[model samples]
Target: MRAHIRSTSMHPSGNHIDAEVDVRTLSVALLSGTGRMGVHLSAAWAHAGMDVRVCSRRKEKAQQIVDALLSGQGYSTGQIMVPPHPCDRPAPSASWRLQAGRVEEAADADVIVLASPFHVMWRTLEPLAPRMRGKGKIFIDLTNPWLNTSAPKGPRGQTLPPIPKAEPQASVLFHKTRFNDPTSSWCHAYRHVFWMLIHPTGPNPRCGERLGVELLGDPRAVAVCTAMIKAHGFKPVIRPGGCEVAPRYEISMLGRREKGPDAPPAAGSDPDGLIGPFSASPLIAVDALLEKAARHFR
Candidate 1:
């Protein structure tokens, strides 16, 4: 995508900066950079020409994810990727750069995407929230409480983290308890389905499809986030009734899935062997989501 720098806003510190720059030039910070959604988003935002910072509890882990994103290496099966030349270095971009950082630095970005698991969201946001105050940053919640079920163990047989107990109302609970703030713009988005986040190499793999992403939050915040979501290659569906009814929309979308509404898709369901089923569920119909979103707007 071409970098388009449009509009500007002065920093709260009394300096001129493009803090309110359009999506094409927006800077993004993805927390849990090594997590499933974070890794994909880091690559997608970087490919979209946005300055991206991938943060992790351990800076080294963040660095590893960032390196793979920039170098296009070590991606797991089922992800649509364009691997880099074996001996070639990543071509530097004049408009964007990807970095490995911590939550403190991430909070200062134009867009802060919370991709950590829902069970850990509050803990993750505790320290970072204070730093984002009065910054006009947009916080996009990508965390979903996985239906209050026990998570399956990893291949090594280690038990995974349990899903958040706040099942159907996870987003509502999140905003009410930990993330509500008047200083920064925040919303629950990209939580219902994220299969479109695939193919981070760019050229918008689902360009013509215009997959709809349901967003619930402050109007001003949703508008800004809408632009960014569209620029990154998805249609933004603004759900009415603000954050209070976030759970309604979340349930509406998930319930419309062709298969596995109560549980997530099976891992490795993507025949191409790129991203896992949770990230890119094969049965998720983009057209159906758009249809449902259209009904909401009516």
Candidate 2:
């Protein structure tokens, strides 16, 4: 599955530019930098040649995470350029790939990776919506809308609760909030996929060359994110009908056995052991989800 990379070229006046946007040059901000997903993704993107900012409620926590990620890779403190202020942007001439900042400073980025827990997602982003709106920023929502009583950790290091039998379908999480804007687009990805499966240092994928990642959003935004996923070494399995039918994707992890009407068939084929007994592994759940969606929606 070689993804076709294209320029998501947007002009200042909301028109298309002929030149392609450099995936490496994209400024990415990871919200909740101390979280499991944030730690991995921030490092991954920074290593992939993107200017990444790991942002958190506490700037010190974000700085510590950034310093750790850099040190883990054998980079020294002398290589890092710590910003004097929380909102200060990295110097345009500086060559550092990763930095740390406050969550509100995420507005200065080209892409915002929502790595916060589902329970506090809206509360975290509602205020930042106005600052991020009309800025052509892409919002990558990796949060799952599980009705968890409390954040539960799965056996395989996944944050998942028991799949609820019933859930809402009226509006997808971001669409119901202030994030549904014309200038900026939101793409639902990394939801069902476990962090261990996609993280740089995690398990070696059972699937040979490509591991399918389910993506749902505007075509242009999806295309841009598809390139990003490909750069990170994962195949993008984009679902049709855009975000309108995102609710079906939201509960796809419940598997075929779920009694709820919203739960779509997990997958028509169980090639990766995704359709059998519940394992609570996102690798299986997400594989089953994208496989079923690829068949049904195609």
Candidate 3:
């Protein structure tokens, strides 16, 4: 399947598919870059040379991360710009950047990567979703929400309401996910699908630190995304579960078929888990993943 490309004048299904930017330079926004993991990912992207905007709820924390990266080993020595307070309004000159909020940062970004947890993403995105619709941007969701709780509700997000029991997936090795509704708005707005899943065999998905983008959505978009992610220091591969259900299948992998020691409790034999890390081989991982996922290329 090809990428559903469009511009400011056409919908994903409109007459704008022919003319689309093939992702030259990406303005990447990491939602909660102040946190440990978020900071690490932002630093990695910066180190890899992508124009990035790292945002956090607090200004100081965000600056702290940028400072550490600029002065620390995150970025190559003298290879990056480390400005004081990367997000000072009016846009100052800097290497490592900081953004006080996602809205402003997203305005210049081609791809916005959500580093916030599952429960937090909805609240974080609700106010911004409408403004982001048809921005022709790609959103990378790294939040692993428990299914019963934080799945997106209502398509197009016109209702933009969070579920009652929808809660955060605190760091624990157990507990099944509480999946919420699937009528997700980004499904259409930003053209999202599943990427990567937990394993039932050797290891789980490394908590929140998986290193590959297991694309399972649009073939063209996934292919394009793979090259971009590869440029940004991540292994990119297409996964088996495609169609629109890849995201849900990913959620399911975390629960049934126990994998590693952290597998969620289940009955005797729930089908082991899903497949292992699709991007493992580095040599043939991309080819293998794409070959398996190709069937869903509608």
Q: What TM-score fits each model?
A: 0.65, 0.66, 0.50
Query: Which parts of model 1 have CA positions greater than 4 angstroms off?
Result: 1-21, 77-95, 148-168, 195-197, 203-210, 252-298
lDDT of each residue in 1-298, candidate 3, tens digit only: 1233444232233222123433434566776655434554565455444566777667666665565555542321211222122343432224444334543455456666666665566556555655555545555555554444455566775533233435322211101122121222121111111222211111122322444344444333344455445544445444432334333333433443225665432312223222233323343345335544653572
Q: lDDT of model 1 at residue 130?
A: 70
Model 3, TM vs. native: 0.50
Report lDDT per candidate: 0.58, 0.59, 0.42
Candidate 2 local distance difference test against the native = 0.59
CA shift of 99, model 3, Å: 5.9
Which 10 residues in a row give candidate 1 its minimum summed lDDT? 266-275
| Ranking of candidates on TM-score, top first | 2, 1, 3
Question: Which candidate number would show the highest lDDT if scored against the true structure?
Answer: 2
Best by TM-score: 2
Per-model root-mean-square deviation over C-alphas: 11.4, 12.1, 14.5
Count of clashes, each model: 7, 0, 8
lDDT of 2 by residue, 99-198 (tens): 9999898888887888777667667888888887877777787776553533567789788643333433412444434466777766677654544344
